[model samples]
Target: MDELDAWFPYETYRPYQREMLELAATCARNGGIAMIDAPTGSGKSSIVSALLAERAGKKVIVAVRTISQLTTFIRELELVRSRKRTLAYSYLIGKRSLCPLSGGGDVYRRCEGVKAVSTSLMRERAGTGQLVPSRDPVIIRQMKKLDTQHPIICPYFIKSRVFTGGDGNALRMLPSTTLRNRADRITRERVLPHELREMGAGICPYEMLLLAAQKSDVVVVNYHHLFDDEIRTQLYGSLGIEPHEVHLLIDEAHNCGEVMQGVMNTAISGPALLQAEREILGLRRQLKQAVAVTQIIRNIGDFMEGLRNSHEAEDWFDPSIFDRIVVRGSLYRDLSEVVDDLMQISEHIREKNRAAGEYATTAVEVLTAFMVRLTCSAPDPAFLTVFRRDGDEIVLEVRNIDPSGRLQELARSHHCCILISGTLSPIESFRRYYFGELDVMTKTLPNIFPPSNRMVLCAGDITTAFSMRQNRENTDRIARYITTFASLAGNLAVYFPSYQILETYAGILEGRLSSRNLIVEPKDARDAGDLLKTFLSLPARGSSGILFAVCGGKWSEGLDYRGDLLAGAMVVGLPLAPFNRVRQMTIDYYRHKFGSDGEFISYTLPALNRAEQAIGRVLRAPEDRGMLVFGEKRFLEPRVRSGLPSWIRDEMAECSIDSFAAAVKKWK
Candidate 1:
């Protein structure tokens, strides 16, 4: 047995951590993909870091699903470095996420609340400081500097100064009177030129990951960026690198299939079409007098009329008929024509009015973007769809559908690949859907905590469907059952399948439960946050209450109500998403592709995973005392129970929730 201090330096290895490290090291050595199924709080990051240390020179990309997860990973890396200082690391974000301040963008606007003492102090400090208008020549010089080396950073201060001045030489040419006025405005507003530049250049975390991946040894990003076709192509193809060269480590691997489906699916609506039509109309009105422009407008009007008559947007249109409607050829040629026409009309529409000229220029830029998005074909699997609005108009939506196969091809072209995750279970399913083969090696980590820490109870009587609605009699029975459990538990989070079910249960428990017991439902995200805050603030011991939440909701996943803060949970249904038009279409499409069983594989299974995630929220720490109760009877069936994890099944076998009240009373 290896002491925790030997390899981990943490004094002990949690069973799951040891297992995860073993699997990651094996995958790193063998150069194969591996999926790990381990619960949260299992020190997965530590295991991965150990694996990365062994593979010194190679780049590793860890793709997570949320900003919170990315932040945690970075913090964990920082901790690891503190313990072992041999690692070299840099955090990369998308080109757009780079600090505008660092890039020389005037980001002064973002520092509004921070008090600025005096301009003289700012001028004295040469290095990075919180001075409002730092006058240190070197710092000022660095702030003014602009280079293409950091493309993501925006020189917003430079841009703003030029924009406000109306010319590049505005600062130099300013008269003393005007200069004094500008200076006064700057001081009073506390607006620093350098600060404004920084604000504009600020990019999001997703963009940061993309940028970091290029140069950093380890890159952390959201799964959506790598899995989504449009984003993946932009990252790999544009970077001139094969996918396999960069290793991928997905943190929450279980959600990959569902995330892939979401990325591939696209939707178009009526209101969207009308908005696009308005833009087209504005463009047409701008060039009304030109012969070509007039003809194009007339043709578009005719097309809109035909679309209105048909009342269908999905019907295909002949490409030849619309070819003349769209301008093509070289980008320079398209820009030249638009500029020439605008110049000819400049005299008619007084250039003296700056706003008019600005509008025309802005329109030209918008048109340019539209043209590029329409013509670019370096990427593959591109498809175009059109829809019609109630107001006799047409809208077009273009997308790259199903980029997985292309991504796989890109991956195969690389020398080595590693796919690691904490929740990559039922490995065969992921292999079949993502890699199209089961050739990749698989591994599962042992549970980190003792089995007795958390208990799962399939309290198999809670039902909301018509046949088993909790009526007057059943409501009392259900309320009594929950009350009994709450008395024994510290904090309980009960999940209903829908808002209707939640409201129904809440009404039943109205007077029976104490006012101190906070009950939350899906009214809005803000409301949910408040409810969670109240629930967590309760004392760790003897904090008896009910937090009413919906299954597969915002509260279910990405939330931590661990330890004594959350003691028990009740799940009302299987969380099979209601069959709507879009879900039905998805089921039908997958069924046609793979068969009837495919729909369950595609839809039902994914929804069930979400329920599992919700239940997983309670049992966060090793010492956390928690029990999961499933209200739905269907969960007891072999088909549903078979898919559940072995640990969960063992917990369920102990005591079903149908006999919940008696069980709780006996335990108490």
Candidate 2:
């Protein structure tokens, strides 16, 4: 057996697994960045084993995009632990999932408030000679005296700790035996976030997992744990580790840009501004600049109101107009002064609310954050000021168009950074888009499964081009294509460019395909869970279902439609974002950044990535067989076709509706 097999966990390696492992090992050995586009079922999770083998005492952090992905790594590590019985690993999820407190508010803020109260009460008890507050009758009685409406005492947190030494100058706190044992079990066994919560019935699950993570050689966490600046700082501090001591593995990394942008983006809505005004009035007695800040908010609201006449659902809003309005309507000379004053005011309001046991986010805080980003955006070309109409309200956003600068910084700060995904094909484009001139290794692995197990087809007769979408002939052709694809026997999904398009196609296909159950993706997320659950269960009952969903929507990415759950997937059109002034600005920015290929990199590449994610759902494993169809003719175009994975491009058969029907019959 090879020396690295000590970390490999499995009895045997899959095809090309050793190659991807070597890529990860090289990344670890050289302390550089590597991007690997390994198709699904390539056992990409095993990359963690390579990182572990190459970790010369440095810790490995696996950042996943979803719970299922996290569980995959957890299971992989469990297998590793069976071989290396001394292996120590743990995982961290958001406190929202592990917190036992039942309430409706920002989980972080609520956690902070309760921790503050818990610490204060414990310290008070310690001063009174009751060092073991978790066991103190007096402290328990004191906790009971608190108002029931707003829970200030977090019993789990109190139970998770125990003080050591004297209560005065030599005071210290350590994890209780129960907490330590629970956390140790987490490191020894495969404990998911939910299981950790169950194990921590009396102790704090987050605290237990955090303790486990501190001693762990490997830690699994969500993207925000490392991508969001504040969260990363806090998490690293809590774990007592520096970025240089960590080797990073980002799973499903195709979504990294979007997730990083989410962390960098800031927005303030009209209702939020109105609420800020109300908050200012309520705290007018305490805020010395309350009057000025209130007027500035109204001016900002008026600025948004003025743009409501544009008749466009979304558009770019010149930041200069905002500056003019704030200066002209308020006593502030510039945005810096306005933002500084708002920051102090928002801080004061937050502190007051915390004191009152109300930890929910206030609008003043949102306004302050937005203004800070707006002021900062003046010097940052990557940031854009945009507005969109949400019913009767106008929401302003400071959107970050490029997540590379931050991602690059993060990559350079780590011991080694490895990004892996199934759809990060055209690896050179992603390398340029993500790292610019930063020297990084790129690897693209072929489909390890047999080519005959899946069939990829692209239509040559239809397009959802902007000009052609309104054409009745085009609409009729798309409906006919969808209905034809629906003729398959098992679960299938047809992804459209937008919900509007999905609804239009749904309307056209109504009462046309009655044999298959139709499941339309909801506009809101409330019902998405139930919708997906219902869709997945259909195949087991020997029923066929067709899911009409939008590309890049909830159902498109970050999901596995394994085996019979999804027999075929058809992408209706290129999922290009609707063109607007903001999009144009983004294209212009990228064009300037990437030169001739800027438009393709910034605009076309993302759309194609979405379509790839949609159609790539078929054939999750080596034995899983399914059909893949690209409904748009653009997929046949050289530029777009070249951007897709080599496996699909090589196996794809171009066909029209009649030809597709013939292929479908043969496929069955």
In angstroms, the error of model 2 at 620 is 0.6
How big is the RMSD of model 2?
1.3
| Cα TM-score of candidate 2 | 0.98
lDDT tens digits by residue: candidate 1, 182-219: 33332223222234233233222222223334544555
- Clashing residue pairs in candidate 2 are none
Question: Which candidate number maximizes lDDT?
Answer: 2
In angstroms, how far off is 546's CA in candidate 2?
0.7
